[model samples]
Target: MVNGFMGRVLRAVGMAVRAVHVGGIMAGYALLFGAAEARRLLGPRRAGHGARAGGLHDGDRWVKMLTRLGPSYIKIGQLVSTRRDLLPPAVTGPLSRLTDAAPPPSRRRVRQAVLAAYAGTRWPFREFTWEPVACGSIATVHEAVTLDGRRVAVKVRRPGIQWVMERDFALTLAMMRALGAVPKLRKMPFKVMHEQVGSAILRQLDFPAEAAALAELRTNLAGLGNVRIPEPLADLCTPEVVVMEYIIGLRRFAPGDLDAGTRRQVVQAVLAAVYEMLFIDGVVHCDLHPGNLYFDERAGLVMLDAGFVIRLPDEVRRSFADFFIHMAMGDGWTCAQIVIESAAHVADDCDVAGFRAGLTELVQEASGAKSGQFALAPFAGRLFDLQRRFGLFPAPEFAFPLLSLLVIEGMIKDFDSAVDFQAEAVPVLRRRNMLRDRTAQLHK
Candidate 1:
């Protein structure tokens, strides 16, 4: 098992390291080449046409480059696309394929993990099957029952998963820092996001942490009759193993698969959870991909995998709240001020005035849309452009908020064509900001 862990870890880490160094540099050159090609093709005679073609060309190259950069960077590419709060979707919009249906682990290895976690201990149940009903990168679930026939779900950690995750995460940070400067991970007030995201990876390795998080969430929403979080069995909780009360129902009934009424309920439920995470709880379940949420016909809603939680410090929360409201109220100066506050350790080479101007344009363009729609894809492009030009960066503190928004945007788009993100977000944001504003001296 140790050898298996080390071997897998080395393989993933080696690949990630190579991807960022070799793949990133090669892709950078390719981008430079493409820019030259487009410029020469259109010349000064048609700069607008050239820029348009170049934009498309850049998009294509980034996807190809990320593919070559290996799995780790590819995952980051997907996160980049979804971060509408930090990025306009335009840049990441084209990179959406990263998180789409990853390959599942083999059944044989999964069984081995189940046996390892249980250590051959016999269950009181007449039959406890070991087959994966659901799957993801590092884990899968098996349905089982107690001796008295109480239905439950056994979540088994994939063998060697921790090794691979840690290796990849370490390599990613190394490469990112090699490319740019960053402070420590979450332990540091001024850390890089590459470092911050790694904390979630580390925390997720310990299943006990996940069990505890679920317990706390249940406590938080215990009285909210409609919301239900599974209870983790205390006797069954271990670092590598977990047993939880099961909702014996199919998970992930996609938006189009249900009747309009059911679909609307599902959409609203998802929206409400997202709103509460951002505005009320401040602790977010950062990964709300379809599979992480369940619609129990009888129980209303159930959320899973609280291990990957993100809680922002109060100061950063205020900054985000202020930024959000400023955007909603069309207060560009306030918005820019809040955005600036949200970043730390910006590049010395960056032009403060130019960066501010770029942000001004972004907020203006986004706010100008006929109904204040969240034009994510285009906005992502502007965000990337801003990042490149001004090095506008994510403080370790805002990591959860940004990630939460990304997940929410994707969920919103799944249901409505006219899902105006700005409009949906504004009201809740106003309330949060008002709270912060009151506590912070009332705009003195």
Candidate 2:
């Protein structure tokens, strides 16, 4: 009884200390950014000095604070970067660049974790490297060769990471709750957002779940012909460790690195695969950032990391498909109606008429814009802003599907600026029967 009491006291004290430390850093940065914005607004305007320049500066500081707070903050930042509606372009722009690289734990710790995961069975690997090939917040991957001489990647969870992340999330929840006392912040659903993110992060600790996702995605994308998903070794996968086929020669490439024809082929394949996931399969991969995506001449488009996948409900999938289809056909009223009908929450005092009018104008402007004139990032920002203005909140389901596309938009544009993004979706929409006769007439 005494020992248990002591443990509880220690845990409480630790949490308190963490709260102070985290709160101090956050408050400091908030003040710094506030002052910077004030100065920018009051100072004389110079050539090339404007909100964009100031925003970039503030973005750098925000990145530094997140990095300093460690893995949990970094992961949250990466997730928040996708919500273009919540933040400005300058901020989300830098947050999107946040990488998950961290130094690997000691080799001894990794070996112990691997052994603990396979306690009852004989080791499957004939050769295993003690050193990690890559290290991220939750796990580190090492190269290994199976008894049958097939090479694979073995991912081992970091020791004690789950407890650490749980503690961090608890602190984050507390901080968010305190922030919620503010009237403006209270309406934003920050608590709900944190809970969703916390749940996703916790689920990522389950290697078996990720392994299952990899298998499901591989099967779903098989018809695409140009995408590759690593095959998880089922017999070797455990809650704490996963073994998968190791792909080679996967590297980042620029638009100039590939021939024009190859670029078109790769971009089209990627778009088709993403649309299939969002519309047909309903299994969307949310983390398609550059680090998780690579190009191989032979493999085509190689996608890695299935830890952040989300399965959308059939209704949500159909709603998103309808929204895109209507948007493509220049039917702004239909697009606005789709958003309202699919919204997760609408304030009691929501300005429905204003929202409808604003969204109609927004969608029509986007649809009529010429190639190279419309961009998804800015459009998403505006869409979210409009929602915020009218107190309408889109379903969480909308964010991940859009995130999948936003993460790859820059790369797609770089590869082929003239590519018609809206038109590309017609094939999938038609396949799903989402393109009604109205769409048929427009396409014709």
Q: Give lDDT for model 2.
A: 0.81
Please, what are the lDDT tens digits per residue for candidate 1 over residues 208-326? 88888788778755654667778888676657777788786645534656666665556556666666666756666777655566667673777876767776676776676666666
TM-score of 2: 0.83
lDDT of each candidate versus the true structure: 0.64, 0.81
Q: RMSD, model 1, all Cα superposed?
A: 8.0
- What's the CA error at residue 249 for candidate 1, in Å? 2.5
Superposition error at 383 for model 2 (Å): 1.5
Candidate 1 wrong stretches, greater than 4 Å: 1-108, 119-126, 181-191, 221-225, 257-265, 430-444
- Model 1 Cα shift for residue 337 (angstroms): 1.1
Q: For residues 97-139, what per-residue lDDT tens digits would candidate 2 score against the true structure?
A: 6644555689899999998888989989999998988776678
